[model samples]
Target: MPNLNFEFTEEFALKMDQNDPLRSYRDQFYFPKVNGRDALYFCGNSLGLQPKSVKTYLEKELENWANLAVDGHFEGEDAWMYVRQKSKPALAQILGAHPHEVVAMNNLTSNLHFLLVSFYQPKGERTKILCEAGAFPSDQYALESQVKFHGLDPEETIVELAPRAGEHILRTEDILAKVKEIGSSLALVMMGGIQYYSGQLFDMKDITAAAHGVGAYCGFDLAHAAGNAPLKLHNWGVDFATWCSYKYLNSGPGNISGIFVHERFADDQSLPRFAGWWGHDEGQRFLMEKGFIPMHGADGWQLANSNILALAAHQASLDLFAQAGMEQLRAKSEKLTGYLEFLIDEISGNSGILEIITPRTASERGCQLSLLIHKGGKAVFDSWYAHGVVGDWRNPNVIRLAPTPMYNSFLDVYRFGKILEQSLHDFA
Candidate 1:
């Protein structure tokens, strides 16, 4: 964590922004307007602001489609047939995996089902899957359905772990102990890289190790952690993982999702998978082959051709990530979120109306700070929205604010503090 004395003043924020190395990147994005002004956007965790370059990127594909028509698949430099490769290097860097280990494909939930077919092979007594309770609802539904598809009762086959008592976050030790207790019965250990509601980043490497120790396959739904947190999925020895590109990656809404499969599975043709023509060997794909000779790596998971326009928009943001680098972005993220935490603590003082439920330690969280509101929660959130503050309110009492390092600045956080202070007063 970069330790710097934080002050709750406008001038101090101005100074911090003026000195920020990543400040210029903020201008590269288009912010939504509220009340004739650019809104303070702290909702990147839900949906990211569009990159200015997305227009040009999309137009390029549209031109290729209009000009080349059928030839566009193999004609120009950015051929539609192989466009997925363009984002590989940047995706590899973001995921900390070999290029062959990761590939952009179907949506998050769809990919999860595909991966479960390959990894969640329950045999004999080893028929259990462990995951966090209250995972994103889609994951819950997918897991439940997958277990049911295998003729197992979800209540008996899937274990959902929750934070103990009133705690909002799971301790790493408790997770490991649970893995040990499950022992050989656990066929899979599936979890989110970061808990969506609590904004807690899990110890994925440790969890993976513990799962392997118990002879179970480990994977993660990295929808919240993908570009926001530092991940070395290859080094962690994780068997499989998947994430959507729309949130922290700033791709358009419901854009493509990427998956990582360890190199150890690269040539394992014996593993059962839901095969498709796109997953077959590229050289033999057009031959109208009768057999499914899977591609050597993560590419083997693809079920269909890439969405050219989506990939174009996705590449626009990935190109920015390649230039900016994840390490530098993560450094700024810590400072931005830390400053937000500091200001929240300072303003909340003895007011018992709001509390930050996100983990305080920098390494244990990303940019999002989930606020647990005790009084006037909805009214306070509405006030912030009316006043040009853009954040998301979860059901019950939490408001999620993500200060993205790519486009958000210290000034944004400072302004949000003023809005929050006033909203609290008005609502109280």
Candidate 2:
């Protein structure tokens, strides 16, 4: 790779921004203004800024509700029952999944629980669950609860894989080894697609194959991975996956989440699920029959009526995603994020004030870079916020900066580097 330090200059950064094919995408979002200027936001890994068109989408629903009342479900311009269907192709394009394999439904954790109810079949000797050691809290909680619900002891039935001592990232070889050793007794193998803290993109293809070879079901929590990286859930043979849209998806906070069930399990009517009216077959839905008949694909997994307003907001974001193809977005992301890494490495040299815990390789990580502040810790990070550079601090000493390809630019990375330099100098 070319030297990142020499490649970024004021003139060069400005020129790159000018020639950027995706530069117009910035206009779609609404960023917070600070001190009469738009703040430099690098927290897309946590909460993405809302799209400008979202308000219009919400207003349309409000108007329908006012004019039609209960009749709006069937008579509105965008019928509520069919609203999710509109977003399927767009979301499917982003995830590299077929439209029939994906569904828009409940929030991330709820979907995870629903999926586990059907996929995590722990019987006899194959009753242990395997996951990364420091998974997102919600995932950890879901696993523990699932084990408890099955009347099993979590301490005995849950196995967590940790990185080697003195290392922050887990090696693929180590993970495979552990899976092989515990193969026969493992009931489920699930992990975050990209680790939230370290930003390491786990090898899903390898892991899924191993899990299947051992007769275990494999799933993924794509909370931080979905739109931030390229994914082919179907081709990878993952049993199931779920993701929130607020992060790299650029949907607003608490926006609708999505779930994917490979075609292999689509018609497995034998699988047990916590069913609801929404999951019932749409053709016979009005029949109010005693027995439930699920839709042939992912739509069959829905449990209740969806929140159409949130789905509308999600559509606005997905429209933008579709316009900017994921492959193109990912290409720009590699260069933009690589530029960020270059800037930080230059400024932090010999100061020993910070260290990047996220992996260095472009292929091994996503957009977020976790900075381990070595000097003033949280105090130093808070000062950066006071200076109008917005990023997230995750306990102890880490500040995460996610330079999203859709909105963030090379200049933003350069400005953040200057701010970080000043903060470190002041602390010394």
Candidate 3:
């Protein structure tokens, strides 16, 4: 593709959208309406649009539930016993992990808790947990509860790495230095694969390697990064990770989440985990003996029988992911986001009302561009929404716009820029 002019002009946006290969994918999602018009939704970083195929996939499950009843667990066209397995390949393709290394199960936070129970054993001096400060509130809550559960003081056992004064992004050097300083006291180091508010993509390989150098386990909450970035969790030596499918994955709200356990730890039965019958050996699971025999590998982490309907709905979105491929999706993503950045910069030139807080380097960030409005505040952002622009607003002053390449068109970004300009003028 040629360089896109930074002018917020319809002709330029239309031409770019016309040339976009992934443009057709936009029709696959259901965009909510504001007032008889399709809302320019840029909030896929929070909740993704529903895939058209999702309802069809879910309807099949509902029909089977209605007709087949309890027998559907073993007799449906897609056996529920093996329903989770069906999603394994498709999910592995997106995550760059082997099918055996990934399992689609409970929601993201619940899996985080499950993984913590198994991985976060604080012994001797190695009882500290280091994480990014200002992580998602749910993560903070879970981390605090976990620390308290271990009878450790949250202040002493939990260390939060934060940005420097007046800065909005964390530096890798500072994080590494902190990890080394904590050294033996650190039991586990976990962080968001991408910062939720700042939109900075952390260097997972380096972070994990740093933690491992000190004999600490490293993991990630991939809620924002899963489908938005190319993740090589296995290759990066990520001990374990969890992510929800709703955001960039296009699975509906509260969709089934997934977990990744490194192949190295797959056979480590000595590791402690709170297991259930569903994790028991499938070959003899029906025997229902008193002993708990977990299936080998990531499946062993499962605590209950898979939700077949949720798995099917997630599978529908995964099919689209496999079809588009992450590399291509990311390629278009960078360009589309770069285009949005350029347009924003163009419109804000000399205005000094909006500041882009996300990293300027494409390699250091995802598709999201967090705009910190200077003079204008939430009132200005609200006016943009009034005109059908549907980005998200963080507390205080940040407006997050994510141009998801899989389902968002360049025209949408262009229209957002235009509306934002009008909003600024009106607010002024």
Candidate 4:
């Protein structure tokens, strides 16, 4: 984590930007406009800005489809049949797993369901799954339905862990304690890699160990953590994980998601899964075999052939990630997000109008800092929007600002601070 000795002046922000190693990346994305000016985008947690190269990537695939038609699946430089392989190298780097352990596939929830089919095994006296309270709605629905599918009552089969009273983030010790308390009956330990609402990054390594010690499978919903935070699924011994590509990933909205299954389970043929032709061994795939012979590693979980155009757009951003590197991006992200938190503290001061609910430490969060509105509510958010600030507003009260290191700069954070100052005063 960078030193919090941050300055609130524009000159300070400018100097920091001038010294940033990833500063050139800001020009690579197209920002949305507010009124006549480019908006200060701090919504990467919700949806990332589009990379300018997305069009070029899409065009190449379209041309291949036009000229090759049926042959496009086999003859093109990036054949649709093998397109999933193109993303593995970069996704592996971002996810800290071996290339074979990760695969780009269905949307977030679908992949979760598929992984649940294999991981969420409930035997006698071991029938409960644990997760954070207020998890993203999709995860809640998936878990609820999965429990019902097994003819179990969700109220009894699922455990939701909330923060302590008056707390907005779950503490590491508290989470571990809960895992231990749920020990004997815990079928699986599943939670978001980062809490979406509180911007809290959980200690996956320790949590995974605790789950394993208690004889349970561990998994994560990485939709908010994949590109924004550093992860080591392989080393942590995470049994399974999945994430969407549209947020910090900078892929198009609702694009394909990625899956990670530990190599230990790679060739375990006896493990149960919903099989499809795409996941069959290549040698026998064309035979139209009556039996399902699964491929090794995460590839065995794929349910269908790759989506060429979507993978094309996904590749464009993954290429940039490969060039920029996760370590370098994470370094800048720490400082950039730290500066935003510093400025928010300075502006909010002792005025009880707003409070930052996100964790204060860099290790406990990614790039997002969710602000809890105590006074102006949506009116204050509207004021920021009117002043050319693009942030995410949650249903009742919170405003989320994610200063993505790939494209956002110190100047953007500084500008948003000024806007926030004005908006608070006007609403107050």
lDDT minimum window of 10 residues, candidate 2:
1-10
Using lDDT as the yardstick, the better of models 1 and 2 is: 1
Candidate 1 regions off by >4 Å? 1-3
* 196 Cα displacement, candidate 1 (Å): 0.4
Shift in Å, residue 170, candidate 3: 0.7
For residues 1-428, write the lDDT of model 1, one tens digit per residue: 54489999999899989988889899999999999999999999999889999999999999999999999999998988888889999999999999999999989999999999999999999999999999999899999999999999999999999999999999999999999999999999999999999999999999999999999999999999988999999999999999999999999999999999999999898889999988999998999969899998999989899999999999999999999999999999999999999999888887888989999999999999999999896888898999999999999999999999999999999999898788767766
In angstroms, give how far residue 224 of model 2 lies from its true place: 0.3
List pairs with backbone clashes in candidate 2: none
TM-score of 4: 0.99
Residue-wise C-alpha lDDT for candidate 2, range 267-372, written one tens digit per residue: 8899999999999999999999889989878889998898988888888889999999999889888888888888888777878888888889888888989988
Q: How do all models score by TM-score?
A: 0.99, 0.98, 0.97, 0.99
User: Superposing all C-alpha atoms, what RMSD in Å does each candidate have to the true structure?
Assistant: 0.9, 1.3, 1.5, 0.9
Model 3 residue 165 CA deviation in Å: 2.0
Write the candidate numbers in order of decreasing TM-score: 1, 4, 2, 3
What lDDT does model 3 reach?
0.89
Clash count list over all predictions: 0, 0, 0, 0
Error of 3 at 147 (Å): 0.7
Record all residue pairs in model 4 with backbone atoms less than 3 Å apart, i.e. clashing. Answer: none
